[model samples]
Target chain A: MSKRNASESTLAHDTWAVEARGLVKQFGDNRAVDGVDLTVRAGTIYGVLGPNGAGKTTTIRMLATLLRPDAGWARIFGYDVVKEPQIVRQLIGVTGQYASVDESLSATENLIIFSRLLGLGRAEAKRKAAELLEEFGLTEAAKRPLKNFSGGMRRRLDLAASLIAQPPLIFLDEPTTGLDPRTRAQMWDTIRRLVKTGSTVLLTTQYLDEADQLADRIAVIDRGRVVAEGTVDELKLSVGTSSLQLRVQSPTDMDRARQMVDQVLGVKSVVSPEAGKITASMANADQVTDLLIRLREARIHLAEMSVQKPSLDEVFLTITVHGVKERESAAVEDEHELEVTRV
Target chain B: MSNVSITPEIRRSLKNHTSLSQSVRNSFTMAYRGLLKIRRTPEQLFDVTFQPIIFTLMFTYIFGGAVSGNVYNYLPIIIPGNLVQTVITTSIVTGVQLREDMDKGVFDRFKSLPIARIAPLAGALLADTVRYTIATVLTFAMGYIMGYRPNGGFGHVVLAGILVIVCSWAVSWIFAFFGVIARTASSVQGISMLILFPLTFLSNAYVPVDTMPKWLQWFVHANPISHLVSAVRDMVNTSAFGGSDLVISLVGAAIIVALFAPLTVRAYMRRT
Candidate 1:
């Protein structure tokens, strides 16, 4: 393969893998991406977490130089995304949620074409394609057209294609959004390995646990804005140390049980509109032991109860002063999180 | 190979400096990718194949006796005309396929690469030349089977084929521009046919311009396809390569390329 010298002409903003300020994109009257800013350190996996309409994809598109921002500026390894896009293009690789590999071509052909476009020699391109398919466990399907490949297989091949020359910064938008459990775990390993090998990664995901597992830091976006940004622990602490969810045995006894819960746990609870389930955040997880005893002594029977990390819904509740209408919408979004296709 | 690992510590900031020569090479590589797609699905060539054979047979027998007094006498005139008409009309596929290709997510990957922005579009247009060549050779072969012989040597016939291919390649750019801007593949085809039908049918492809009314004759002569057909006829019939008709067609092709190539590239860049 032919290698070109690293241009000394690049600017001094190379320390950070990505830096952006006031990035905005509008489609018609709706601003898909509002004035948003982000900074990603090198050799780290940064996650942008949000609901389905949170503009995470739009922000990544702007940073990858795929879409021009209507306003704002971004730089990739010291190159302006707009003014020095050619340099930016060289430094970044983007694997979108939709498989960007050609559907008509086989997996091997897709990799080779991507490699050849990056200036690899013919034989080297072939070798690289084979190696990637092998690494991605796609060697058996290398000669089959992408249309015949399953969703998990397509995702792996998509990631493989972007890693052809292994660009310094890779933007993986919802890389594991639609995969089965096994495939999801495989993708996580691949992403972790990418960072471990010295490539910085920026990934967007809707699943909170995905962000918790992979991201060193997470940015929670909602309705085209970053509502919260920090390490996952910081976000968890902001929501509360622990989440308490309980269902009462008798719907009529919910009020007494809620009162007992408030008196013992010292925290107000929000009753779900159905099933007499009460959700509350706790300052100290130890308070759960006291609340349970109070419920038992009141002769208030319980259907079920558990204390765990808060769902994304509770996080939205704590972070934003959303109205009842907005909160209902966020609850509706949580319903979607349960029905993973498991494909 | 089964033990392959992807954890190599690749140079994170591998600068890809694409010189003009590298851009050209990238375009050709894209063209090779186009050819590979064709190899996987050879049905894509059915248009170029069936159009030439079926159109040549149907047009020659149906129009020969009335237009030229006999089928035998009409071969030379009809063959060159059919070659020009079939290939120029076939150029519309370039734009249609381009629109379809861009609609897929694959082009997003292409746009993110450091190669020339125009490479994929240019490569697609270049690959369509092979389609034009297939139409040209098939039309000539079908004509020979139907008892037509070119007085001009095979060299001139090949030259005529090259001329028609060049012009059609240029005509494809206008359609490629449509492909870039039009929202759907069907719409690109719709708009291209709207523009091409009148131009191809009004030209002197199926009949002599003198047979039309005075007003119609002027338009037929002015039609760009007419200039191309007459140029091909000059080469195949009288072995005349230096005629003003050939110059007009070549210059027209050059002008179309100069105008639409960059225009299409600009539109493509904006969208991509």
Candidate 2:
């Protein structure tokens, strides 16, 4: 009972909806989720960005109380997952990587059953089921077995099921992994609506653009570790320099354009002669204007010219790739040290 | 895309969560779901209904003359035997269906809910009582149609049916344990059959124990299925619950449940 009071007081005072510290999960020889930490603020979407096998799902599972962490601890809305899983379960809803609904049951039946399990009365459960069906735009197919529904429909129903109790926090693991572009956009809208209604969300995805579009803060994970975590703009800036790209009017001017841009930017420009294009990284917005002025003075006409901010994709790639290279070099150094000791 | 407002009813439901009574209610809700699955796919009932009928007919006709000179005389022994065999074998469905549900990731959905951990497994076993009842009643009907009337009368015949259903439900806990621990549904089926085939066939269910060799007779007498079949015969034939066999059968079922129910629940908890 004192634990309940503690949780309630913490929930009122703390801005964090979910916090995980030094989480670890080992599956035999592979450290599926190595020591990881997370801090998700209330009423905002926090995204974990990673490629496959990056431990995103494992981390979510631990926070959702489905898997116990081997080392660290997590809390949802001030209730510790390990100590008070029941209270934690009460606070959070989880939509796993796969659609976890029963395919044999109709969509309406699925919703009603989940509502009942969440402590709704029979009539109330039915009413909520109908409302969720309508809300997810599945009212027309409510009576159809879930097996017949499209992938997007199933995913929507899955999300609807998690929302039946209107939990304060929701964990969506790879929510739009296999969805088509239009369906993914629709799901993003649903998520945005959910946030507007005052639900904190922890979303994990392999899509960099998805995190950039949805998350207020993002963490990039690779090989069971977080390599970088920050706002999208900060991550782009951390990777250093936007790119200055220009296309020459004629293919013959591509070499000239590349040389001039190289001299102005003090770096080699990537030249594509067939496309009459040259690209060079620039540290500041003023560099783009300076390059344009220089090109104009040299009488080099351009078909297209623009300074492009580096995409989150490039930031993520650079972070993860550099992390792997660092680890590899560290391993090499360890081996060299071992050789020296042996000698 | 307008924000969906939370109704007051939903807020109330969320606030008052996870009580013991709510767990019981949730268990029944899950059981109702299991029943719905069976209703949509009636083929799942084939083992409990048709298998019992077919096994009774096949065994009685094929071995009746050899064992007892006529099918009518053999009906007394074979009917109870078929009842026990069919009902116990039907318990394997619990584990198989559990494995199928797990494979489909339905149980993972259950894991996130605030309901009791045992609700889904308990509800699934409760819904399976329907299958056991169906097999119990059909085996008797098939027996009566085949000119095998139980002299124990209606009251005692029902007692025997109830006993078989209860015992079969207990045996299901064992298979359910297998289902939770095994890697796949097909493996659960294979492993359960490997254990059940010998228990049912090696007992004195279909034939008198005296006819077997002395060593075989020892095993036949010791077999829990033998005790269950004998208990069933005592109730259905004499209309009297007088024998020690009935006590042994009930105790055996209790022991199976006592041993495997926790094991199954523990394994299921880990997996989910």
Candidate 3:
């Protein structure tokens, strides 16, 4: 991992599919995107994981050259987004949160119109439209207007429309936000296929499982800032080790179990007497057996026990929640420091 | 999971980006899409086809006897005036439809494409010319059926029709500007109607300027709508060209296009 990081840092700017530095966007008094920086490698899926209003969409908009950043800059394959927006536009395809195809036009008509806009000849445009419709499984509904299309079908057509020019970079903003489980899986397959075709995809999603399943690298953004970024395993490991959870046979034994766990593991345990469960974080998996043996020697009855690695869901929650708390306490500390210095 | 094979021609076109001629071709393609929409939803034609027929008949019968002492005498005045009013009012759809398209995020798709920034707006305005033509022809046909005959020959009538369509197309640019800047489709329609109502009604379209109050006559004579109506009246009624009114109407349309086209494009670029 260290070696990979070193090589990534040494990669030339033109080789990176996307590079954004200190991008900021302000809407009235609200800074929708505040000092965001992103680097995406070619032919890889870079997932931006964040809750709503975390500046993921805003950052994507700026990088796609749809919205101008109030500060800083971005480059796509060494073409500056602001200075050479037309060339950058030629290189990227963007599928926004909303289905952006014309609802009044049929699926075939939508694809053909986009192809024609990309400078395709009439026969070529029609052939390409047919090919894309077949690939997206919309051949049967090609003649039907998009207003009659289901959400999944419309999204597929939207993706098909963006691929008319076969752009090297694609931006998908919450591509599966409202899709059902099956449709989301299909969409994920489509995204994987895009990457297989040598397209670099920058996707922003709020679902932790989505990033874990599809992203080569995930950036956790909270309140317009990246709070954590790494591979899924690295993110989970950053939150600390696996936890040991055990439910005592009797509610009365919960306190004893908690004390025994603290003594054996050298870490504080949280005991819930009502549920009769005691949980403690363990530094290593080998310590799990030691904990059980120590509790047994102390004659603590155990109804259940398990050691589980923290899921990416827990890591995301921990990072976002702790990030908010840290910012708030830091603000308070700054105020106190200001008072002290004034005196 | 594999990439779709691209023809060598397509690959070359993709690398060439967009030239001026390519932008114009793309704009027409967008306009063709707009026309296809109108074809599938034929009810969108009601505003151009039915509105002219209904308004010409209703206004001529209702106000003709009162304004001109007889329906026959009012035919000449009301027909041309109604043509101007109906076609100018038809221009409002350009902005309303544009706003609706923007609300549906269609412009978001266009913004990411390597096409001219003005293509969508230009295409929408171009497609609306068909609507103006329909309104112009229908207004005249309805007038002829109601016993109103223009002494102007076939050539003058065709010229008058072309003039009205061109002026309405120009007026649509202002509404397109409003469409780009307004918050909603309904608001765009509301604001356009608010601006158009006075301009259409206060002109000599329905009632002669002499019948209006002396104070109102000043605005009636000064209204650009009155100039267009007078221009149409001269061409259709007398079969004449080179009238001062025609020059004023043409200049007015040019000024509108020059003033609002850049403003609309600028606002559209910022939002997209």
DockQ of each: 0.45, 0.43, 0.34
lDDT of 2 by residue, A1-343 (tens): 4234634566463678888889999988878799898888888999999877778999999998899899988877666888878777777888988998999999999999999998789999999999988899999999999889999999999999999888888999999999999999999999999988888889999888999999999998876788888888899899878888899886766677788888877887787666666888887566667778888887889998877888987887677666656677664444433432332
Model 3 per-residue lDDT tens digits across residues A293-340: 988887888899888888887887788767666667664444433432
Error of 2 at A98 (Å): 1.5
Give the alpha carbon lDDT tens digit for every residue of B1-272 in model 3: 45463222113223324577977997899899889988988898989999999999999999999999999999989999999999999999999988887777667899989888888888889988989999999999999899988999778889999999999999999999999999999999999999999899989898878877899999999999999999999998898788999999999999999999889989999984
By lDDT, is 2 or 3 better? 3
The numbered model that scores best in DockQ is 1
Model 2: which residue pairs collide? none
lDDT of 2 by residue, B180-225 (tens): 8999899999999999999999998898888999999998899999
TM-score of chain B of each: 0.93, 0.92, 0.93
Who is ahead in DockQ, 1 or 2? Answer: 1
Task: Quote the TM-score that chain A achieves in each candidate.
Answer: 0.80, 0.90, 0.88
TM-score of decoy 1:
0.88
Q: Which DockQ-derived CAPRI band holds candidate 2?
A: acceptable
The candidate 2 chain A region of ten consecutive residues with least summed lDDT is A334-343
Worst 10 residues of 3 chain A by lDDT: A1-10
Winner by DockQ between candidate 3 and candidate 1 = 1
